[model samples]
Target: MKPSGGSAPGGLFSRLTGFPAGTGGDGVAALSKRQWTRLTAAHQVRAVVAHRWAVVVLALLGAAGAGAVTLAQTPVYSSTVQLVLTANYPAKDIDQVSRGSNYVLQRINTYATIANNSGVAKAVIDKLGLPYSGEQLMANVTVTTHAGSTAMEISVRDTSAQRASDIANAYGAEFPAFVGKLETPDYVDTAPIRVSVTTPATVPAAPVSPDPVANVALGLLAGLGCGLVLAAVRYARVRTVRDERHATEITGLSLLGAPAVDRAAPLLGADRAATPAAEAFRQIRTNARLRAAGQRLTSIAVVGSVPGDDAAAVAANLALTWARAGDTVVLIDGDFRDPSLPGLFGVPNGTGLADMLSAGTPANHALQQVQPELQLFLLAPGTPMPGSAERLLRTNELTKLMESFRRDGAFVVLLAPPLLANADTLVLLSATDAVAATTRVGFTHSDRLAAALQVLQAIRANVLGIVATRP
Candidate 1:
């Protein structure tokens, strides 16, 4: 029996989600709260980074949209004029001149605010005969005083560059007169303080708003941020079985090995030349031997979820590899629905597995040699028994066949039907000693693989590992 919960490798997510251990009832692993949280974050981030094309496309579209919006906005121009404040009081000494300069500097800040006031706005607007009122003109006007100096600046912004310059110069010309009248006494003809324009406003050749390069850059940044968020969301929702890592993580199965797709690789190991698929099969055979050393695993079932998962290829190559290593191996085509062993090895499927099981045919007469010199044997599906295939597998005939193969000192490798395709292979699970699942890279879905694992767990089958077919 599986334990309730601990630090066991298999039940990591199921514990947190209240699902049974080693089952995909809730589509979650049997993990503790902390472990589940950590795995979720890491897995989601990995998925997002794995599919970066979606993120790039979204980012590009976001940047293009922002650039289009920036181009649609109206451009604005700003013009500025500078003024200097000076005290007219006659100074007799150097100390008096210093004191007068300090007074002028202190009054500059006050003059800056007064320059943008409604009174100055009305005066400037009336002199220029502008269409706007005092309040409206004041809305576009701004005044700033330089630090530790008697200099003040008046700025105006408008859609037209000439209008912006006219408004700025008008404020500069009117503020000095407005200050002079306000500061002068009732009987005095002259004022103690005066303001003079240092730099006149000029019409700007370029607009300040709607900078194309800056806007496009900002849009790119925003778009990239949005794309990463979208990628993370997509990764969290969709679960696709892409490689061995995902297969092992979701199914709690060991990673046997990944075999490369090489059409030049033959079914039997008669060709001594080393190929990627051959080397991979040799390694998988070693792993299976190590796994079975502790248990009595004589009958091995190689199953897949889909038709193109290469389960038959894995079983045939693995049997040949073991036979080449001086072990007597028998490869059985257990999938009567879609028998592939005869076609794969170019053998006649006249007198094989179905005949041996149904007619009490002797194994010596039914088994076909993969090659005359090799100890590898083939038990291909003899004939199509579509209606009674599941019943034949469910009976004691399969168990007796395995017993007979075990007595002959032959390791049996069965290529069963796909788990999702039909339930014919599910009937043979009772007699199978160990199981290995095969999945095609970038083709199988995680949900179907999880369901297959759940069925294996339900039947209490010994899970050897998983074989990933690299495209």
Candidate 2:
């Protein structure tokens, strides 16, 4: 993006829009809300779904890397000895009775302190004839209560298993002498409280780390988290509304519950499951209910910009859903060029919409009831039969047909041809209360869809909302 000098560089609308006068990020070409919705819905949303696999791969790599690193490291032996303290040292008068095993855990810290003290480290360093200082020598030592409980252990790590054992013994060997200075026994018994060694540490024959299995497990977990988070963020930021919240945000439409796909014919069920595309249409029905808001909306039309928008499928499923909901539903196949509803419901071709319009057959006579409360009507597409298609759509009889469907308590879903591909959609858009357009990922172009939306806006078509098709 070029810097804004406040003249749009070449007098574009950016200055008028108050965006910086540039031609890239702040350029006139920047996608509008409608275009952004189309672009992101057609691209980013599915990309997030694809990213799950990437996340899994990365997580596995991370785990593998961690494990390989752990395995490749040089082996070191750790020695630990559990100590049992019978009484509190340096403060025996405090109470030996209640202290019990806690005395062992509590006093062990003092013992560790004495063992790793400058004096002890110096002694060990000198005994081993080490070049390192006392502090440096003690840095390798550790003391702790196991599992946040009252059990104490003294730990030391070294490169050699034998040397590790020797260090453990050396620390204990000097511990009593050091503690003797800090506290005296009430009575010097025949046996002095001892710090006997336990589980002398040894260098293992096998490496203790670089676990491939663990790495893979952690990697998978990491990938799942990354994938889920990415999917959520993508879902949240999407401009395309699939639910009620999106209804108000995108087209100012209210949200009704998603209508169920009518499960009547074998083909309809198969079609519903064929691509699992009904959910988008179901949401459209839901938005239709919202757009109707207190007023009656008997004639609901589904439109799009191209073929393969599954406009017919949406019409069928929506009619079935409404029929199932105890409302009469008429599924109108109004795509006068590429009629596809005949095979869907086993209706004969060539004899439906074209014949009805040309013969001046009643609109109700053109309808075919597909289920108990659902009816299927064919508007067979091809060349219009003289004052047929457009005339039928824009007539008082057509209005009366719609009124009859409403009077019969039915919802009508007219499956119209895509706007860009058919003039009939624009012709019908005028008579209908609302329009719902479909956007398929990858197949639908953002800019073109935005232009179509602009056209719809100019005509003031109450665009119910958009239903994005899954890739």
Candidate 3:
């Protein structure tokens, strides 16, 4: 089978990212700084795309904010008046008009700046009776001349359209008098340079700001960018096992099977149901049995790191699978704190493992026939005894019971307590021939799985493999 992200489409990207040859895109291997950065970025993008609802929500929120800001702002209206700055003189021939035109062109730039002078602004303000000083009026006015053109444009912006038009027209009318005074200090009938208004200032039809569509678009882009960043951060900091790939990478154990996440379904294989969950249990059973034969295993113990995991369910279903295959099988509920074998098989919980241990009763006395047609049996934990359960599990009677089951040509499966929750599972380590860990993806933290594996290895338990539940 080809490794994940190892196909031609992703080969170049995987090499640049330094992903291992036989590992998947979601590998948890420790990587170099550059590789980590690239992989982390890629993972973040994938995470965001996989969860599209986040993007929609963020975009909507951003759009709403931008729209609100645009609406809350004050609307402004602008008016512009064009003036033709021509040389004014009585020309006898074309040569005189050409020379005068050149002279006026040289002074056009000076006139553009002069139009914004404090004196010119004050004159316009007084002429229009505006409610502002020369400096305040200057803030609302602008003057410009197009390149290689003798036309000058003066503009005024205000909240009121009428006021903007009045201010613009005042500047156009007053500028000519100001220029005349500068050119000829003495009173004269005509001036060398004259300014004339070609296009008079008119009230604007609409406001120039607060464009709804543009604001919303910008906001949506900003929100989506923020959502992408958040998704990346969440993926980078995740510590739980997300899938079977993550579990195998962290534990370095063969992945036997991944049972479906179903809270409503009954114990798989109990009724010989041909469901995905049941098939998963059968696969796990086959893998475990193969490993057991090579290691000369007689009794197998199924355990987890924490309570509420599907460890007991896996053990029970595995025993049923073997029994269905015409092999004698017995499931032992070793978890005294929370025994589920009696409830799962619908047998009386009275007089079971605890009873067998108190008295030197035969192991079969407590064993209940789960399926008469098939060679399947169950040993319930009976009652809750959290205090002495660990001590009771470590007794010599447990070893004797395992040997008795093996002699009867029946394979034993112990649904042991969570390894981290109690020491009962460790007690079964010496008696059981093989151990299998059950884990729930997303719910199981990588640290918890690692710690459980460390304890099993420290005790020299023959760990067959790991079975991921609800992958």
lDDT of 1 by residue, 278-309 (tens): 88888998788787787988878999866778
Tens-place lDDT digits, model 2, residues 1-471: 121222212232222233432222222234434434443453455556656676566666667666766667666776765554454334465455555456555666666556568887777676777667777668877776544343456677766666665676666566556665555556763222345444444434533344556666776687666665666566445433343333333333333333332324423453453334455445556667776688657777787655665566666666665665567566767766567776687665554555554565665556666553334444444346654565655444445555666777666777776765555565566656677766544444443344445556656777766665443
Kindly report the root-mean-square deviation of model 1 from the true structure over all alpha carbons: 6.5
The ten-residue window of minimal lDDT in model 3 covers: 1-10
Off by over 4 Å in 1: 1-72, 94-106, 187-192, 220-239, 262-273, 384-387
**RMSD (Å) per prediction:** 6.5, 10.9, 10.6
Leading candidate by lDDT: 1
Look at candidate 2 and tell me the lDDT of residue 458.
51
Residue clash pairs of candidate 2 = 59-219, 67-210, 71-210, 336-381, 336-382, 337-381
The number of clashing residue pairs in model 3 is 0
Where does model 2 exceed 4 Å of error? 1-56, 81-112, 130-133, 144-153, 177-220, 227-301, 305-308, 312-427, 432-471
Total backbone collisions for each predicted model: 9, 6, 0
lDDT of 3 by residue, 1-471 (tens): 112211233242234334432342333234211232343444666668766688778888999999999899888889999999888988899999998899888889999988888998888877878889888889988999987788999999998989999989988889988998888746676778989999999999987776788889999999988877777666545655666766676677888888874655446644546887888888888888777775777778998877666786788788887788888888888877677778877888876787676676676677889888888888888763545554565567877878888998898888887776655566766688889998887777665566566567667788888988883
Give TM per candidate. 0.80, 0.50, 0.69
